[model samples]
Target: METRIRSEARSYLFVPGNRPERFAKALLAGADAVIVDLEDAVAPHDKDRAREAVLRALPELASVYVRINAADTCWFDEDVGAFAAHPAVQGLVVPKAANTEALAHIDSRSHARLALLPLIESAAAFTALDAICHAPRVERLLFGTVDFQLDTGFGGDGEELSYFRSQMTLASRLANIGSPVDGVTMALDDAGEIFDAARRAQRFGFGGKLCIHPKQIAPTHDAFTPTEADLAWATRVLRAAQGSAGSATVVDGKLIDVPVIERARMILARAR
Candidate 1:
């Protein structure tokens, strides 16, 4: 197996593959990774054009992935074909991935050593997550909140879709994969709302968030990365528990245990 690509911060910015101008800008915008979206963002008639543009730009990206249409889409085969031919492509984000078979096809066809980030958007896909993640190419699970809400008739409020989001995270953990990505916060201008949403997702074991706009990237990264205070507290807790074992350790009058230690280590790792 290829070594997993670990993201230091948890903000992924989406840029339209058709818009060549935004490609370099997104990479420079400090997002942990840039997802060059060829599906949804591109018009049906422009799919071929967008594919060409993306192929031309792939060589310029530092860390990037392509979001292809689902396997059943008319353009799915073309999307995979284009990616397979591009040696610069590092990863692929398959939207609305329904099962392992779709991923298996991608694995069998891809010539480029690309990791798979499956976007779980439908109820059926959620149910099939266990089998889906077991696919050889799958690296991370990404929740597609907007499409999911549309498919399930769920509301946008965080509470309404909490269960689904949690299920995705739990499934990723069970599969021993990288942390699941929370869906994007659609409020582009509301930094406060974006921050709150990212933090909430973090609490739910989501290691990262998908972002639509460049403005949302900074706040999302901030929300996921450990703050100075957080790092200090974590360092202190680890030191206090250096020679200790058992269920808990008291740090600054607060009790800490395995769960707390695990969280602290995650914070420290992100810090590094």
Candidate 2:
């Protein structure tokens, strides 16, 4: 239940709950986490079957996260009831998360056993970010970039969404939640594009990226990992700052202040 232990996870790969046949493949795909999706991935007619399918699959599989339907949907309660106490469930990836009251209800239903990953996908969610982050058992926030664009009428996902992305990061920091996760890259065949997008998310202060395809995993991990040069620079910074006795020092011609030293430590920690 100490979900913060997983705050450093870099990739969350989504697998359709209705397609149980693909579960094993996804679990072995080397993602930081595998999310069995019962939300947007499942068709209406298959929702009940998907729920049952997950119930059967959970026993045979290792613990994995489940992305359930939003609280507004009829399927929401059923999804929570079925998986709240399931031993094989690591947590619930709650979609379209906005209301803190509903989040409290979900926590009660789960008896606080499951971690909540609130997907910040709408304007309403942005407005209530701090409240949602502070909601009971919320382990992390996820950026639902695609749905957010549709909801907010953004024509593109580039610089247009920068402000909102930063807001999510700031809200997460204020709430002491894990750095928010970035949404998926639509390109399945292009690892370069996926890597670029993941790097962009990292620049915006996101801790992870959602992966729709297994192919996206390696590049995503590569993007999040500190490069050799970065590690070397961080090492130099730490060495330079040592024995400074709280005084500022110089590293690579730049003044190594407390913030710079702290940043170096973070970079080294990430490398580890």
Candidate 3:
């Protein structure tokens, strides 16, 4: 059976694994989830040490996820064996994930119940999107926009990435998983930029965003939250749809059908 994808987290803050000192601070920063990164964030020389530090600190952490090195890396097996079954680990963020075999391998190593958040970062990953989504223990897909750009030679994050973003969202929807998480915005202190980027991601059907800093959390949440006008419209849509008794209805001069009603309910769900 596929793992249940029920996480409603809208902000995932990444803390470098080697920097154990920042673990508590990231958790308390109010991100819906904290990712203890052991992949790109950690330098090659520090890989072993970072894994050691993260494993040692797992008991002190609460419901945290770990971004382990890619399945092809020499360190992958050790990282899996060390933390996959640890109670403190809520999930494992598998970076550069492209196939079901890799996900199955990770699942096999774990003795504890855990979700797998696969990073869709390469063209290869896009080709195998469905396979990755339906892989064992997989729960959510995360768009690694930066790496994807690098891998594909995409020139910019805007139009160049729109189609890719849509593909990720569409694949997740087809797999019945939570909407994929968007990549991080580079701005650390610009709330407006962060909020705009997040809003764009939301429009593209992403449920959350990756954060490199704690400051991005609040703005990310603000972007995902339904506005007053949105809530009111959703309420109106729901009320009107309720009286239709399975028939299409009219609301605000537009036809309200099953899809529109579902959209309204989704807006209200996000608001709540």
Candidate 4:
């Protein structure tokens, strides 16, 4: 089986694992993938029930990604074991993944086709980015902004987090994995805020944004999609460069170099 990541995914919606009824609804919510969160979202008392619900829903939720509890926790072992035989899960999202040991453990339980997405949040995880990205079955890393802020005592989310975001991008590219996914936008109903946050992450080289609610999926996808203005500019640049025959040409007072032309081509490609 070929272990692959969903490169075209722009939005990932989270649904609590205990709610099996909402599992189907989440897939229908228009997200590229639905994540059944067993950590943070599920209470300690309901861990067993949530795990049971998630395992049962996997076959029905084709694109579902399960967020299992950390390896240090008791439920972690059981979470991976339950999903091991199912193989219907597209991916497993491990929160606060800081070492290779846990990844190896989960890899031993699951089939070869299951992709691993480590949610890098702790300072220790940051230092161990290379190991985590290179771990067996690791498809990509997901930035946990809210938890990271709490972990690192960082207050601002804009510039303060760029360093971590850049590290995620660089490490993933070097590891030859899919682009890292950015953290979620807390403002659920505000499309403007969600779009801005996702656009910033995309500029930082992220390929996807985490969605806390269904309303955020559309705004997140729109942020990653090329706009009409971008398409128009790319078209103009392509036309000018076509006649220039690779020679340095000026378009809108800017020299159209190889890198500039490449960006234009990317925009046009995304438009298609």
**Which candidate's lDDT is highest?**
3
TM-score of each: 0.91, 0.95, 0.94, 0.94
Regions of candidate 1 where Cα sits further than 4 Å from its true position: 1-9, 243-249, 255-259
Worst 10 residues of 4 by lDDT: 1-10
Question: How many angstroms is residue 229 displaced in model 3 relative to the true structure, after the best TM-score fit?
Answer: 0.6
* Cα error of candidate 4 at position 61, Å: 1.0
3 or 4, greater by lDDT: 3
| Model 3 C-alpha lDDT per residue in residues 10-128, reported as the tens digit of each score | 99999999999999899899999999999989999999999999988988897899999998889999999888888779999999987787788878877567889999899999999
Top TM-score model: 2
Give the per-residue lDDT digits (tens) of candidate 4, residues 153-219.
Answer: 9997899999999999998888888888999888988999999999999999998999999999999
**How accurate locally is residue 56 in candidate 4, as Cα lDDT from 0 to 100?**
71
What TM-score does structure 1 among the candidates reach?
A: 0.91
Winner by TM-score between candidate 4 and candidate 1? 4
Between prediction 2 and prediction 3, the one with superior lDDT is 3
Counting clashing residue pairs in each candidate, in order, gives 0, 0, 0, 0
Compute the lDDT for candidate 1: 0.84
Sorted on lDDT, highest at the top, how do the candidates line up? 3, 2, 4, 1
Q: What are the lDDT figures for the candidates, one per model? A: 0.84, 0.89, 0.90, 0.87
